[model samples]
Target: MKKWLKYSLISLVILLLIGTSWFTYTFFIKEYETADENVDNIVDTDFEVELPDTLEGDLLDKNESTDKNVNQSKNESTKNQNSQGNNKETSTRNKEQRDTENDNSKSTNSKTQTKDNNKETKNQTSNKNELTKENDNDDQTVNNSPDESTNSEEESEKTQQDHVTAEDIKNRYRPTFQALQDQALAKLNNLVAYAYSEYKKKKENGEKVSYGYFYKKYKSAAKELEAKTDATFERLYTSLQQDLVENGYSKDEASDVKAYYNQKKDERESRMLSKVLDKF
Candidate 1:
């Protein structure tokens, strides 16, 4: 039994030695592989550290560009603000200049208007003074003419007597007839002057004064005169006839006065026409 036990112990001892050897070999191989893996990781980490410098350079360039852009934007904004300020100042100055010019023009226009008004007022006053002076001279002339004054007094006395006899006729027949007569005389004088001027023109032109030409001109002038004189005579005779009738005159007496006045007017017109024709 002892011999068997000794053999068994030897076998166990040898087997245990062999197992320890195998375990130690496996641990050494695993440690070597782990150390290699750690070396490779350290090399990779060193390479990544080298790339960080290039990345830092790119980041610095970008930062510099961004700062430059920010400074340029600020400079441009300041320039724009200054330009706007200058434009505003110029516009203000122009507005002030326009206002000043407008004010000056208004002042000049006001002065011109004032001067024109003064001139017009002076002219109106001068015209009024001249009219007053002319009226005074006419009154003085009327008062100084002895024959005219005597005739006027006689006419006034006759008018007063007629008023007593026919108040209605006196009231209706005013001195407007004298104005009418004066106007008619002025027209007659103008007609005579015009005829004389025409005759002078005909002589100057060396035109022949044939009987046919003279008759034609005379007839034309007579027709025009008749048209004007007939209207005047009708108006005056109608008014006179109306007055006479209203003054209690008989219709026959009113008709007689109208007829006589018409006859006298016709005779006067005929004589005037004859004189005008003879002159032509």
Candidate 2:
């Protein structure tokens, strides 16, 4: 019985030890496999997060390049518009300058034509006056001629009288005529001097001067001188005619003397006017 009991106990102890060993081995193997699986999942999640970030960075760089290209294109377009505007402005200015020059040229041409017309008119007027004076002289000679028989003796006397000449007539009238001419010229000179002085004063002050003002002043002076000279000649003629009548000359002889004096006076006036014109 003792031997059977001991044997049973030993068997029981062996069974218990075997069971403990199997449990420990199975737990250790399961824990190792679970830890390896967890490590693999962590590595795959890290790789997924990193790949998205890199893709986002590449997209941002592409957008930036597109924006830069768009900005460059806009700048080029603006520069082209400015260049066209400058060209148009330059063309417009040139056209305006050309038009101004053309207008000035036309104005100059018109002024030249007007001056030529004025000169031609003056020449025609002078010719007409000469023709009129010649006609008057011919009429006077015709009216003065006497009958043929008396004309021969009268002609010889007339030849002797005419031989007294323009020089003799000029000598007789020169002193009185020169005095009147000198007076007129002195007045004219004074007027011209005054006008010029006034014009210069106004010009210095930056004022405009009109040609009409100068012309009117000159006309007034000329008219006053003409009136005074006409009155003097009339008085002289009346006095001389009265003297001839008082001396008991025949009507015809007194008339002839009066006519010769009148002719001399006209010639003297012409010479004086010539001198005045020369001074002008």
Candidate 3:
């Protein structure tokens, strides 16, 4: 039994060793070699996965779209920032412009006020000058007032004296002028009566003497007498005017008296002419 046991043990040991050797060779060496060959095939051959044509285009498009979205987002953010900056700049510029306009307005107002003040000052000065001139004129008028009054009184007295003298001269000469006027009127009446008597005698004698013819003859003789009377009166008036001038009466006053007497003569002659017509 001992000897059999020893032989059996030896056999078991040998089997176990063989099994171990087989396992090492199959698992370690063969598997390792196979995995190494697979790695080499993956490197050498085209072993990368290949996508379909449509899937590849879609993927590329998707990637491009994503990149575009990212760029657009970045651009939008930048634009927003730029717009904000522009708004800030615009606000600042507007504020500055308002300040500048305010300053200019204030300056213009100040200048206008200064000009108005200067003009007002000039007006005041002109008014003062005008007042001074008016005062000077008033003073000059005051100084000359007495002399002017004296001259006016002297002239008035002279005019009164001359009027009194003219009245005296006219009174002194009136009687002589009346005599001449009465004498001339008497002559005119005599001539008118004579003419009427002659016309009546001719008609009574049936001598065919028209009253008009007798009236014409009477007018001719009366005209001659009137001419002589006028000549005499003219000479007498000339002498009277000369005497009046010598006696301090003006020639104009003497002429007025002559005109009065001549009007009286005309009245007397017209009355005489009316009486002669009535007789006819």
Candidate 4:
């Protein structure tokens, strides 16, 4: 029995040892497997963490590129705006310059036209002055005609030694010429008196002499007076001629003197006639 008991105890010990070894091996192996699995899981977790950082870096780079593109767009837009503004300023300046030039051209044209107008006015004024001078010359010519005629007659008389001067005629035969002139004047006065009386009588009789009556009577009276005046002057001229011959004057000189006396007498008669017509 003691031997069986010892064997049984040894068997129990062996079984226990086997069980312990199995348990130890199982525990160690299982622990080693778990450590390997943990290592794998840690590697996977590290890979996941690094993947997120790479994605973040890529996003930051893309953001920087976008910023650069935005900045470039802003610069391009500013340059375009500046160019537009410069072009507009240039256009405005050109317009102003053109306007100023046009104004200057217009002013020049106006000044030139004014100068031309002034020249025309001056020419017209000069023409008028010339015309006035011509008119003045004509008037002078007309006024000098009588003096020229008298001068020519005096020159002819100067050629003769026996030509009677005005002083000589006044001292020598003035009384005779005066007596004859008075006689003629007295006759003309008497005719004027008769015409006045007739005009007064007709007016008082209420026969306001019509134009025909007045004209006919004046014409007849003028004719009678002219005939009487001519006859008286002829007698006086004949007497003067005879006296000039007695005074040692040539016939031609005597005739010329008589002609001068007759011309002066005729001028006096014309003045008297003008006065009479004015009264009528």
Query: Which candidate has the top score in lDDT?
Result: 3
For 40-74, candidate 1 gives per-residue lDDT tens digits of 23222211111012223443565565556555655
- After superposition, the stretches of candidate 4 with alpha carbons farther than 4 Å from their true spots are 1-171, 246-248
lDDT of each: 0.53, 0.50, 0.61, 0.54
Q: How well is each residue in 1-280 modelled by candidate 4, as lDDT tens digits?
A: 9999999999999999998887665543323212223222322221111101222344356556555655565565556556655655665576567557655665778666776656655765676577556556655655565455456445543434244443453344445555555555555555555556666778899986544444444445555555655665566556555544655654454565466557856865686577567656
Off by more than 4 A, model 2: 1-174, 249-280
Instruction: Flag the better candidate by TM-score, 1 or 3.
Output: 3
TM-score of 4: 0.34
User: Candidate 3 — which pairs collide?
Assistant: none
Per-prediction TM-score: 0.32, 0.29, 0.40, 0.34
Using lDDT as the yardstick, the better of models 3 and 4 is 3
Residue pairs with colliding backbones in model 4 are none
**Tens-digit lDDT string for candidate 3 (89-176):** 6655765675576556657787667766566557656765775565566556555654554565455545544544556656656666
RMSDs, each prediction? 71.7, 66.9, 85.4, 83.6
Tell me the tens digit of each residue's lDDT in model 2 across 37-141: 322232222111110122235435655655565556556555655665565566557656755765566578767676665565576567557755654564454
Sort every candidate by TM-score, greatest first: 3, 4, 1, 2
| Candidate No. with top TM-score | 3
- Candidate 4 weakest lDDT stretch, 10 residues: 45-54
Instruction: State the displacement of the C-alpha of residue 7, model 4, in Å, after optimal TM-score superposition.
Output: 99
Q: Which 10-residue span in candidate 1 carries the lowest summed lDDT? A: 45-54
